[model samples]
Target chain A: MDYFLVSFFLIQYIRTSLQTAVNHPEWEKRLVFARYFSIAWIATFYIAEEPFWTNWVWDIFLVWLIVVIYRNEVFNSLRTTAQTVMPFVAISIIRDFVKGIFPKFYEENDSFFQVAVAFAFVLCFFVWFYARKQMKVLQKEREDRLREEQASRAQKESLEYLVNERTQELTMQKEELQRTIEELKSTQNQLIQSEKMASLGELTAGIAHEIQNPLNFVNNFSEVSAELCTELEEEIEKSELAEEDKDYIKQIIADLNQNQQKITHHGKRADSIVKGMLQHSRLSSGEKEPVEINALADEYMRLAYHGLRAKDKEFNAALVTDFDDTIGKVNVLPQDLGRVFLNLFTNAFYAVAEKKRKLAAEGFSSDYKPEVKISTKKFANKLYIRVTDNGTGMPEHVKAKIFQPFFTTKPTGQGTGLGLSMSYDIITNGHGGVLDVESIPGERTEFRITIPVSEPISQS
Target chain B: MKILVVDDEEDVKSLFEQKFRKEIRSGQFQFSFSFSGEEALTYLAAHPSEVVMILSDINMPGMSGIELLKTIRRDHPSAPPQVMMITAYGDSANHDQAMQLGADDFLTKPVNFVELKEKLLTIL
Candidate 1:
């Protein structure tokens, strides 16, 4: 490249030297500048320059220079071109009429200054081209960084949203669970209260029955005493004079005996009622023994009938019994099972008594008396005792709840409301038997208690 | 008729002892009592025909009144006392069993004198 540039500048100098006789002084000074400048410019002008002849000559020279030179630099075409073309122009004029590719002769015969300016112009072009490419690469990197930052921000926002939703759902579930717990607690409390009330009701019923017993005795004895007095007065009023009153004395004696028997009978019933209440309502200290069904049924039926009559003195319900002669004996606590029978009798009487009352109010007389029919039927393994009453029977609803605790169709205070509930407990729970009812409204109500007559109730 | 009142409660016996003392002294009727079912059985075994009617408590510590009645019915059905089971427990299971055991009648506790007199009249 330096040789080419020197040749180029020599041509230019020749053109100038041949320019119609320029002065010797101008030529000499111009020759000195052109000779070394061209060589120097050509030596360094390899990056942006294309060649006119044997293009690799300057590359060989550049290789030598690069091997020895320790210049740290970017590709600065303008500086390289000036460094290479400077010596070419200077050497061109000093060489003895050398012919080379400066081509100022054909390159519009431009002056040496114009050629140097063109080399500098090409250097500027390469620098600008590379600078634009570097700026484009930096822009692409910045765009990718923005996209990554945006994606991270989107992910963080979505995660926060999910956390918020899940927290709200958990809180709602906790509230529902707490509400269910509260409801369960309230239900348990209600059950406890119901049990306490049931026990209390049983206590009160016992007390009422006991108090009524003594009242019964007092009433009967007093009446008997009055009747005896009247009879004595009648005996005194009988005339026929005192001579042979011996036979008459026997008559008075018999009447006196009858009245005495009545007095004793009434007094004993009152005593027995008190005894029964004391026994049943107090501590359970009765002996468990094998008892005969016929006797037990008869006695409990009478006791239970009296209990019902004690409540309503005007009640006049007839009792009918059809005992099974085959059933033998059963082992049980007489007091407990006796109470169950008593309750059944009382309930039957209530049902019949109600019918009687209603019938009487509707103008029916004693022609159609209410009857409580108690019958026993023996089956394979158990004995069935049915107590039925001709009464205003239960409706479907009442029948369904009849065995539930404290359920009653009677007037509020007239019943402890535990009669059927406790009866169910005794017959079913205590005896391991079934207490069932069949009823038809305005017709009859029947309660059938099927119990194992041969089995020990204690095991039950 | 002579009456035998059998019960476990002292008050029941005492009430009768007091109420019937006058009539007993006058030779109108005989009235007696035994606390336990065993004693009642012992008394009845000796005085079988003496007892025209027996008022017995259904519940007792040993040998309940119903059991005594059963023995009476089995051993001496013809001369047996007309038993009336008196009790407080008004449950149907025992009442049904008692009546089924040959008990002539039943009486619940806290008794009414009027009803008792009528029932006695019917039995007599």
Candidate 2:
């Protein structure tokens, strides 16, 4: 009975040890050793009992335990099982033989055997609890480490995104800064150009003033001489002189007249040049007069045409006018407006004449007639004058700089280059108007003047 | 007609004399030249009866034509000669100012000798 009780307890211990081993992989080796030792003790107890049925039951239980361990995948190698179980099996079998030789001594050590089994049960319980607690801590640590890794990855991605955005923003700012720098540089150049023009205007004004005195003397003396020559010729014709002497005197008079005409023509040219420089330097004259716009335009048109014809006998262009009769008197500086009209008309004629000369040179018989057209329109509070020429129109680049002082396409002595600039100043600065040019290369160029018809602006 | 021509430019005397040679030769007119306003005033004080007309350039070195006109108007208030102001610039301010200072006529340079002769004929 005692052996049976010990064997049953041992069987229970072995079953619990095997279950613990299966549950805790970290403690599998130690728990499997305990389970095998308990199994060997149970087998020894059953073998000592000598009950055939109990022995068979124990054997079947052992086989079932092995099957359960195998199913749990914790069953160690056979050598390890033999090492843990064979020693205990050998010890218990020896104990049973000793009891068979000395039954009294074996009976007396039965309590010690029970105590060792109880101690073994306590040790297995302690080991199983310790292993379960250790496994819980290790699982918590692993979960925490995985969470930390995920957080660090997200932080790194956010930092990279921020750096990328900052780089893009910096690039945009740099481009904007570069553009602003270029704008400032251009403005500085324009300012310098204007400053240079201002100084040149002053210098030219002084030079023109100095030239005016001498020019006035030449023109006046030439006229006086011409008048004297006429008087002398009349007196000579009335006098009683030899036929040969009279003929000689007539020849001299003819020569004098021709020379006088040449002198007057060149003097007038000088006078016009001096006038241009003066007008460029002079501020707007503080005088406004009632001027007939149509008549003024017409007069200047004729003057420019005749003036060009006088210079170049070959220069001819058809002049066309479409004046608005309703456009009456406008209060302005007549001299300045006359100059503006004359400049536009002269430029128009020059353009047409040049194109005609070019066509003649090229031997083109194409009926490409050169023409200059003048048109004026009157509004309620403004006047518009349009001058158009079908000639060698200016390219875009030349047209852009046409109004700058000292900028001209004509030969140096032919043009003072201040005509359009002075006209621009007169119309815009002096008369509160606008001068605009439109052109297509090789087709035509048109200049439009728009002047306000309000209360006369006080001159500065 | 006897005229006093006042100008800063010495060449103006020959210009005027040459332009009016016919009239001068015919003894229809006598002309005197003064280089400045002071000289003209002195010539006027000396021969006031001979100078029936005074043509003066408005821009002069010491005293301007307008000043001479004012002085003549002040001194010879009742029997003042016909005073004409000539200027190189046709500025309206100078014209108006000379007119206000008792000038009889105003002309811009270079003066039209024929128009001047006609004007002188009318004045004389």
Candidate 3:
């Protein structure tokens, strides 16, 4: 009995220590230790008696109860109760039957059986506690994972919404910007066309005045030729011709030849003036080529001066030409620049001419003969040409808008103002150069054209 | 002096009439009218002495003024009538060509009659 009790206590101590290590209640181990200890004590009595009463043998039920009730690895309540009470009932029946054969060991109290039943309750509690602890830990982990998943999903949805909204805003802004650019371009083209018409109008008025001068000479010459032809014919018919008369007839012939030559010279000049006006009014294809700037300037300048002079024969201006010897040839579209220079020269002429017109109109005979100075020079990396005119100089307001399209002070249908604007486009926009103008009223109006020395990329 | 005006548009001829109103009334000038190159040639072949100069437009439908000027230069090498271009086509090519093709001068439309008259006087 002592040894059995000691063994039970040892098992109880180990189980209690292990349960404590698991951080669980140790009451189940204590209960199991007490039940097993009772079984061992009862068995010791049977052993000490040597053929102990069969009623004492009922103590063997303890081992069977432990094994059967613990089939689930936790004590089973129904099985433990069966092991304690049902076995006792069977022992009681056996004792009842054996009592008739041998009278002594038959009387058994039920309290021991009840005590075994109480152990079953403790075992059930231990089993429930163990299972509940394991389940609770697993449930907590599952809930935590679910919370993390929900949080991540919310972040993903909000981020996607933000991205979608930003894209929409960018698209709207792009559409608005495109619309504004289109509007600006349309207005710009409109202004350009208007300026073109204005300058064209001015040229037409100037051209009409230019062609009349030569025709007067033709009229006068023919009148003189008709009178001389009659005189020569009558003199030849006189039948008595003197040497002086023959000489006089020859003088008439010489006069006729001189008149014919006059008609020839002025007629060609008139034709060229009209041609220049037409060239200025025509549209350009704007193609580029390797061109001589100096010759180009001379040809157009002469034509422009003639065109202006042809309109008013007495509007004489001193033309000073300075050509840059080192200014190498550059490739350009002649038509484009021809019109540009024409505009600049003619505008210079107009400024001076306007002053001349006003002076004549105002009855000021003081000859403030106008002067136009044109010169080309080689600046670093560029060719700079300046056209300075002593004209009725522009006020600040007019100077500020010199290149603005369609803004001209001339009478309507007189100045299609596209000249300087077109020149601006050619020098700065097309060739990557600069066009600048400076003016002092009644003193000088100067236009500086800076073009790259090297040929423009498009021309090249 | 004789001045020959060549243009496809009859309006231009009448416009010239309006421009030279005084000259026509004076009967000091006798104007010959030829609508086509063949007609102008026939008039020229018969009355070459009366025609002092030809003022022709460039962009006619057929047998252009340049071609006519070339023919006149080729056929009448000596004392060929002065030919002046009077048209709207005044590009560099045309400018260079009219001078090259024996045209004494060139002008562009719409004709400034005052300039036209002076040019006529210079050659007539």
Instruction: Find the candidate with the highest TM-score and give its number.
Output: 2
lDDT of each residue in A34-118, candidate 2, tens digit only: 4566566667765777543444444444444445444555444322332333333334445555556777887899776555545
The list of candidate 1 runs beyond 4 A from truth reads A1-142, A206-460, B89-96, B114-124
- Better structure of 1 and 3 per TM-score: 1
| Candidate number that wins on lDDT, 2 or 3 | 2
Q: What's the lDDT for candidate 2? A: 0.79
Best by lDDT: 2
lDDT of each: 0.67, 0.79, 0.68
DockQ of each: 0.16, 0.56, 0.09
Query: What does TM-score give for chain A of every model?
Result: 0.42, 0.44, 0.41
Error of 1 at A316 (Å): 40
**Cα error, candidate 1, residue A133 (Å):** 8.6
Which parts of model 3 are misplaced by more than 4 Å?
A1-460, B32-50, B75-79
Expressed as tens digits, the lDDT of each residue in A370-459 for candidate 3 is 888889987776888898899999899998987876566775445755667878998887777899999899788999999886743332
- What lDDT tens digits, residue by residue, belong to model 1 across residues A343-402? 788878888888878888999756777888889877887878888888888899989988
Cα lDDT tens digits, model 2, B26-114, are 99899999999999989998986778999999888899888999999999987889999998888788999999989999999878888
